[model samples]
Target: MSKGNIGVTTENIFPIIKKFLYSDHEIFLRELVSNAVDASQKMKTLSSVGEFNGELGELKVSISIDEKAKTLTISDRGVGMTAEEIEKYINQIAFSGAEEFVDKYKDDANAIIGHFGLGFYSSFMVAKKVNIITQSHKDGAKAVKWTCDGSPEYTLEEVEKEDRGTDIVLHIDEENENFLQKAEITTLLNKYCKFLPVPVVFGNKTEWKDGKEEETAEENQINDVAPLWTRTPSELKDEDYNQFYKDLYPMSEDPIFNIHLNVDYPFNLTGVLYFPKIKNNVEVQKNKIQLYSNQVFITDSVENIVPEFLTLLHGVIDSPDIPLNVSRSYLQADGNVKKISNHITKKVADRLAEIFKADRADFEAKWDSLKLFIGYGMLTEEKFYDKAQKFSLFKNTDGKYFTFDEYKDIIKENQTDKDDQLVYLYTTNVEEQHSFIEAAKNKGYDVLVMDGQLDNHFVNHLEQKFEKSRFVRVDSDVAEKLIPKESTLESQLSAGDKDDLTSVFSAQVPNGDKMNFIVAFEAMGKDSSPAIITQQEFMRRMKEMSAMQGGGGMNFYGEMPDSYQLVVNENHPIVERILADKNEAVGKEADSLRSKIESLNGKRQELEKAKEGKKEEEIEQAQKDELADVDKKISELNTKKTEVLSKFSTDNKLVSQLIDLALLSNNMLKGEALTKFVKRSIDLI
Candidate 1:
């Protein structure tokens, strides 16, 4: 027996490993299992090259948990270390200055493990003491037993072992006795080694017999030696891919499509990315893409490995190039990682384009499910946006799908405004905005269904990408003004009549604090609705985006009241009759006040013009007094005019009816207001 200290400059290596790596201490199982796999694979390689004459039978790694003894053991049948090899590989942790290394990276767990090769030493994180019994495959090699009790000191001695492999026994610490549980160990193995290259055995297979589960003689393997992603894409069928997806995510819906990536040039990368049917909630769909290093599962959170938008996809990405143990900061800064991300984005885009070109009908059939993911990618990654344009589709309200260029070409002749800008009309809700959609259709314009959760941001993105193009909601303006081809129609009402009409209609709008109604006259012909509510495109979009973003910088838009234009068609017969009836009821008094107000305004304007070039002292005190008097009389007359109009609007049911009709069309009239409208309609009938 030979006993010596681990060659480390500092004596606090074990405590440091336990303290700093406690957050990710669960990875100890992964590290040990991966080491066992490496040994098994090396044995296979040596035998293939005729370097070893021994039989490489049953290359498997088995995990056993002894709850009563509080020990977890991992045994492997592969090339193992002898006494001399153990001294060099396991005992000697060559640290130039251990104190300096710990000080620089004490806070970063991955940095410490990755900077120095600490795969074997990580067992100290969970185990109070660890023992390794290994036998080398070399002929006449003596088997060795190594023991360390969570310290730099260890003992190495020759031991009798029949098998040419290794057994790592971990005496789980008091605080980490959970590792001795069968369920806990199984879960850790399933998460870290489910797709490893070597078969991993946990315990015997079980059968539900005699009303309970009983162990069978067959060993239960927990990992697949060859997962679907490691095979050739041409050899796979649709059913095979689907089965694999079910295995990965048993509870999720079937994926829409998949892309098989196999690249070896710049870096070795192999994986299968599936386009899952994403819902409106983006947060729930993320973190489904599992990242692996040489089939050893590294993490499900692959945000650093893939673009933020691509995280919506679900699959397995295995690359030998990606370091298994490293900080996310390191992965994000690595040049090779950037290259891999770019390649993945390119491959995804190309695959989408291929699917679209091969079978457009099928692609169109799946557009509803695919649009959310495609829109996210286009909005985030510029390179993806450039490539996605070829296959990205625009779906119309009529359920017809068109490519960007195809839709642009079809609408360029008619949808282009007088400013030579293409106008893309869209509707958020097919039923709620049905009236607006029909009005747009009546004008020979096409409207898209932009109702996705990300459509608000995506619309802004499209505006920046497409030249001379704007997306307008169908309900944002009157159909004639949405894609204006001619000059706007002049209002037929006089200035006074317009004011009285606005006062009459604005008084009846519901929820004055929450909603703001701006009354304006538009000569949209007698066929148009008497009163229609329209929101400004830009303001509406800002509010929508603010609501989705949960209000940071855009919170200003969210806090403001909803503004809508109560567009009264001056050419409509109902509006003209309403004005005529109002004039008959209170026009005489309103006209007298207006005449007095106009005379006072003339006097006030003359006084203001007379003193335009004069200083305050130069102006006579009597002239300023007269100017003030004129302003007071004008203000009094305007107040009387407003009173007369308010009285007239209160008595007129037609005014309330028109305002309610517009509100009801916009789905804004509810509760008592709707009841009042129904009652008023019955009384008129």
Candidate 2:
């Protein structure tokens, strides 16, 4: 027996590995089984090259769990180490047999595991002691036994004759005794070695007999030596890929289509990417894609491996170019990883374009499921946007799809405003905005259904790409002003009448910084509703973004009241009748008060102008005093105006009813206010 301390620069290595890597301790099985696979594959390579003149028998790896003894063993039939080879590879820290094997069979050792050389030491992660029983295939080489107790010290010596392979037995500690179960070991093997190059066997197949499960006549193999990704695309059928998807995600609905990736140059990448049918909440069907490296499962967190948007896809991606042990942030900075990301993005774009060009009807059939993913990709990646514009479709409410240029041609003439800006009218909730959609349709305009969670950001992206184009919600403004053409109409009511009218309508709606009521006159006909509410784009966007982040229960934007444009059509007969009634009831009294208010307003304007260019604190005291006087005069006139308006609100139920009608249309009338409106409608009728 010979032993020496494992060479390490720091004593913190073991503790660091235990503490930091504890979260991923289950990966220890993958590391140990992978090492056994490496040894098996090495012997095959040597035999192919005439170096090892020996029988290359069954190369299957087997793992057995001994619950009573708390032992988990990984056995393999491959090029095992001799006594001396054990000292150099197993005794020294970080030294790996895969390195020597790769050097000997440089071009033929497919899927060697020596890149990081941490596979062997992964045993220390869970085992209190590990034993290796290996016999080299080299003629006259004796079988060897190597043992270590979670430390640098190891014992190795010639053992009795045995098979030409290795079996690593892990004496699982009390804390990790759970690994002794068949299910636990099976799950870890499936996660890490299900697609490895070598077929791995766990134990004998079992049968339910005599009221119990008993080992069958055959060995229970746990993995497929080669998965669908490593196969030739020509050899694979559509159903084969679909079956593979089912294997990856058993419960997922069938994917719309798949991208078979088999790249040789730049960096070897072999995998299949599928576009799943994603609906409503994004995470309902998550973790559909399983990431692998040379058939070894590294992680499912492929955010940095693939673009953020691509995570919505369901499939497998195996690329040796990605490192095994590192944070996602590191992968983003690695140069090769960036190239891989760019390549995948281009491949996805090209695949979609091909499908769109070859058979658009079939592609369009899947558009609803495909729309969110493409839109999200275009929104997040600038290059994807550039490519997507060619195939990215615009679907009209009539269920017709069009490319950017095609849609622009169809709507350019009718949707262009006086300023020559092309407006894209869209509706997020088709049912809720049905009235607005119908109005736009009646005017011979097309409305798009842009309702995806990312559509807000996507529409903003499209605006920047399409020259002279803007996306407008169907109800952003009244039908006529939505695409304003030759628009200008002055209000005819007197200043006092305008104030009284505003107060009469505004008194019904809640008043706060959030609940703003912008009183505007429109030329809409008498048939149009007397009042309408429209949200401003900027404030609405802030609120929508706040919803996306879910930053807190309710953010500042959420806390702010609803902002609405209280549009009152001045051209309608109802308005003419109201103004005429005001004149007859308070014409003389309002004219007298209006004269006083107008004089004070002119003085207030003069005072504001005098202080416009002055430093905030440097304004003259008299100027401040004069502004106060003007403010008081305006306030007094406003008081008299409010009294008249309050009387109007109490008397004219039609005004309040009209306001409620608009609020109902916008789906904003809620709770007690809604209840009041229902009761008032009965009384009015």
Could you give candidate 2's per-residue lDDT for residues 1-685 as a string of tens digits?
5556666677667666655643577878877787888887887888887888767778888888888888988988888878878777876666756766677677887687655566677677788888888888888888988887865566776688568888888898888788888888888887888888998998888999999999887988878888888899899899999998888888878889999999978898889999998885677555566777777777777877788888888888888777655211134358878888889999999999999999999999999999989998888899998899899898888889998899999999999999999999999888878777887898899999888878888887788888988999987788878888886655566656677677777767656775777777677755666677777776776678778878475388866777778888776677777767767776677777778888888888888888887897898788888888889879989799777666766677677777888889988788998998999999978
Q: Taking the tens digit of each residue's C-alpha lDDT, what string does model 1 give over 277-309?
A: 887789999999888877877778888889999
Maximum-TM-score candidate:
1
TM-score against truth, every candidate:
0.95, 0.91
Q: Pick the candidate with the highest lDDT.
A: 1
Could you tell me how far off, in angstroms, the CA of residue 238 lies in candidate 2 after the best superposition?
A: 2.0
* Model 1 bad stretches (over 4 Å): 94-116, 324-332, 488-490
TM-score between model 2 and native: 0.91
Candidate 2 total steric clashes: 1
Which residue window of length 10 is worst by lDDT in model 1? 106-115
